[model samples]
Target: MPQPEDDPGSAPRAAGATNAGATPPDPATVEKLRSTIGSLSTATLKQLDADLPWYRGLRPDERSALGMVAQKGIASFVNWYQKPVSPEWVLSDVFGTAPTELTRSISLQKALQLIRVVVQVVEDHVPFLAPAADQAPLREAVLRYSREVAFAAADVYARAAETRGSWDTRLEALVVDAILRGESSDALRSRIAAVGWKSQARITVMVGSAPSEPNVGFLNELRRVTGRLAEDVLVGIQGERLILVLGGVRDPAKAYPRISELFGDGAVVFGPEAESLVAASSSAQAAFAGLTAARAWPGAPRPVSSEDLWPERVMSGDDTARRSLVRTIYRPLLAASNGLEQTLSAYLTLGHSLEATSRSLFVHANTVRYRLRRVCDVTGWDPLIPREAYVLQTALVVGRLSAPPAPPVAANGAPGTGNGRAARAGSIDKAPPVPLGRPSAL
Candidate 1:
């Protein structure tokens, strides 16, 4: 069997030659070798000088001479020797301590030059060591190094993925909050940057509400459908509102209706096109403004866009303004005396029928004529004039619609009473009890 130093299984060392057949090394010689190597300077040249004694003491040439003897089996030992000089040089030249610290310091300029060449070799060797079937010791070393590198790479990928995901989630949340709050365009822009959104991509805004949990569930279903179409849409909640961010749309008209169909009759607003993320952020705010306008106005279909409703943008901020306009244009009839107001309201309601008005109010036909004439006298309103009547009727209808609903009551004052009409009409003074009695209504 080969001695330990000559065994292929042994770690490579610079002193393999003396161990072939000579007496095993004494402890003194081993200690001296170690001390000599440890004493070398960090300077590579000084290390090379220290290596000479370590190499010559090994008697490597004598070992090579002994290798020809077939019976001695020295050839095996000779063949197993590796790095007869280089391995020791690595331990000494690259890592040894120096007695004189000044001599150990390499010129910064020279160190940099050497480092460049060394880096190039490492880069070039990476591919060679990655493959299988290299020498067992070399392969094991390479694989262990690779495992360390792979672990580092995995850690980096995990960190990046987590960071990006967290950032996007926060971004979506901010957008939704802005939409629900009906924030201003400038505020929306500020929020976008605050959430670390990409400042360069085009952005689109959507505003609507999901009244119940089911509606939110519907929104998620709808989001999945849009995702299948490959549209990048982000969903988040703000207050009671649901806001969505859409991008990469070349044409909006095509996209708008599809969303409308998904949410029939629900309020939705889309903002105008924006060139960049900042612009899109502002545009989303504009769209929310459009939603407020739609809710305030008389007529707006779902998925309303800011562009189509520019003329009436003023109404979004001032709903009372619209109501005031309707009121001002028709106040004359509204403020008329109660009798005249009743007559006018009835005439308009019964479709200009004096008979119907009389029957409806439980009055004589002639009484309605008398009341109509009084209405004309008091307010100068004439049912005969179509234009004036039209205006008066519209005002009355709008006023009633705007007003609180009246309480329901029976026509009769109470049950089992023939005096209901008399009670309602109040008692006539009947000529103040004159000496000669007068008939009622006389």
Candidate 2:
């Protein structure tokens, strides 16, 4: 049994003494050794089948292919022993029998294990085949040849790994592009599946300025950090912008600060969360729009939500932004109660003054306060908070703009007719009239 140090196919070592400075074996002895190489290859394969779990698990065809490699390795060693001074040609002659695809099927470590088994089998047979005087030198040659083979195997696998990495990177970029383009084709899904994207849901897209120079190291570090956070990220760099589609984020706002520094110096905006990657284009569109509109808000947070720039986005003719404001803020408040919407409008119109809004609407101050609270409950925006008040006011304006054009009023207060019947219109008509200096249900 080989000890750990004598593990024949560990890393390659510097070439030592050629045949331990002994005389080369005679031609007769070399022929005898060559005749036994076939048996040696067969025995090595049998030993691998018995001792190596991975070898035993290979399909019959794969095993046959690997057996050919072992036979070629044995024959190559015998050829190397004949000319011990030149071992450079031995690697190609040994590995040339196996196709490039074999490297993909078997890992480098397993290939090294195969080399070790063959070397051990050849070493064990050296004494039986070589003349007594040449046995030690023959064993020494086997060890040296094994070392060279190990190095050759490492080179093959390294090249294979590099190629695979490059291919995967390109495929990942394609998947991100498909997501951004909102193309949910079967081919796109297959491409994403090929890249092994683990997170299917809770996806968010973030857009920002890319660094001035290529920074592979920074991108790698960002990947490492997101991986540690159990997030899946697909990144793309287009001109000066960087886009990242992140998945499995429970709270995008909380995740932003950690990744903000990884972005280039500029406004970084996170889009709304989507249920899954298939629907992430909606999020990506919003983020891309926000990136274009972020300049409008000079005081925008470093990692602002795409929805936070709704006013700017709406102004920029983003129908999604206008519809989002109407759906999330205006519709809900409008459906809850006319009084809630009217009081909210009055408060904002009165500069968020409860007393002033009450006086203007003919309601007591307490009714205005109650309506304001209801507005907060309905819209998740408080009239008391300056920032939220601004959002609410913007939503009101956007909602009115997005609403259908009102029917023309006639002299009689009827829409498109000139009758004298009163018509309910605007906020004041929605609120019940309050007696002078008396509170009313808002």
RMSD of each: 20.9, 11.1
lDDT of 1 by residue, 76-149 (tens): 11222222222322222322232122122333232233233322333344344333333343333323323322
Residue 153 displacement (Å), model 2: 0.9
Best candidate, TM-score: 2
For each candidate, give its TM-score against the true structure. 0.33, 0.86
Error of 2 at 41 (Å): 1.2
Model 1, poorest ten-residue lDDT window?
Answer: 68-77
- Candidate 2 lDDT over 313-347, as tens digits, reads 88888989888889999999889985888888888
Q: What is the lDDT of residue 277 in candidate 2?
A: 84
